[model samples]
Target: MATRAELTEIFGAEGVISLPRSEATAAGLSEDDARVLCDVGFPAELPVIFSLDVPGDPSAFSLVPVDTGADITKVLCLGGPSGNSEMRYCLDMEDGYVILLTLGRQPAAEIINSTVDAFVEFLYRYGLRLKHIASADDRQADEYTKQLRQYLAERDPQAFAEEDTWWNMIFDRLLGKEF
Candidate 1:
């Protein structure tokens, strides 16, 4: 698992900011989780945020508050909106597993990765996917996919498979397939 310092090195100071401990505490995060959040902070920008109803409206993406008061057990909102939002990402407080909460879909909270480290890796891979989709040339995309596969395999093989499956489902849904 990558440490906070390692993540900072990977993401850079501009990309990753340390969250205030007070804010993390107020958000009801556990000590270790709070440390992780406080250390690496949240992603400055999520590369992907597409609305199901409106595809081109940039206003569709916004951060939603993670309600710790909600009835769901042992889950913390990592980023993104809830309710009307098509997808919301979360973390399982108990084990640091990352989960995807898809609204209006069966089996709502899909476990995407086994740990926060793996989850961060997933974010990096997802960003690559977005870039690949946008770029005209396939060379960069192929290289990125190759590197990401190696990173995931080295970090956690199981998470590599799970993230690939989850991203496939997510991409399918984004492309107009019903969840």
Candidate 2:
């Protein structure tokens, strides 16, 4: 997992946006703000990829590289702010659709619903299609999951305190338990 600092360095600090809880909650549009801010934060005219986890409601996130044309305006951080109440990290991507790595101590159903909402909102605003590519065919999911787990394991020293320690601690973290 790449820290916000690392992501900022890779994609340029200006390209990375840290969504804090206060700002998100005060707006009563944490979800919407998260996505839009994330999109706006990503540096324009550059191909970039970033990863981070939200240690709150969702356990992990995966950002897949998308064909956002040659002109990707910005990458969106669609997930809610982390519960740490401190420095929070978001993401950066190529375009079209980016993967998210969210990790939190919440019910599986809630997380899935929230993710679906985020993805739907993004599509609705951008007029994009919701495509489902199989993970078996794409190794990106596996690689992302592994990296996410390693990241959380370091932050969350409880030894996978999310849900299914093993599953959440691995690639399945991105697929969500209900999936």
Each model's lDDT: 0.55, 0.35
Q: What TM-score does structure 2 among the candidates reach?
A: 0.26
Poorest lDDT segment (10 consecutive residues) of candidate 1: 50-59
Candidate 1 residues 30-137, lDDT tens each?
A: 786676667655445654531112222112222233333565464655654322355656667666777766655453666766775566656655554665567645
Runs in model 2 lying further than 4 Å from the true structure: 1-5, 17-137, 162-173
For model 2, residues 1-179, the per-residue Cα lDDT tens digits are: 23334335444655454445554444343454454444333222121111234344322232223233565333333444334322222234322232333333431111211232233322222111111223234466545445545654454334344564432522353445452
* Predicted structure 1: clash tally: 0
Error of 1 at 89 (Å): 0.9
Q: TM-score, each model?
A: 0.60, 0.26
| Local error of candidate 2 at residue 121 (angstroms) | 26
Off by over 4 Å in 1: 1-18, 49-72, 81-84, 105-107, 125-137, 162-164, 168-179
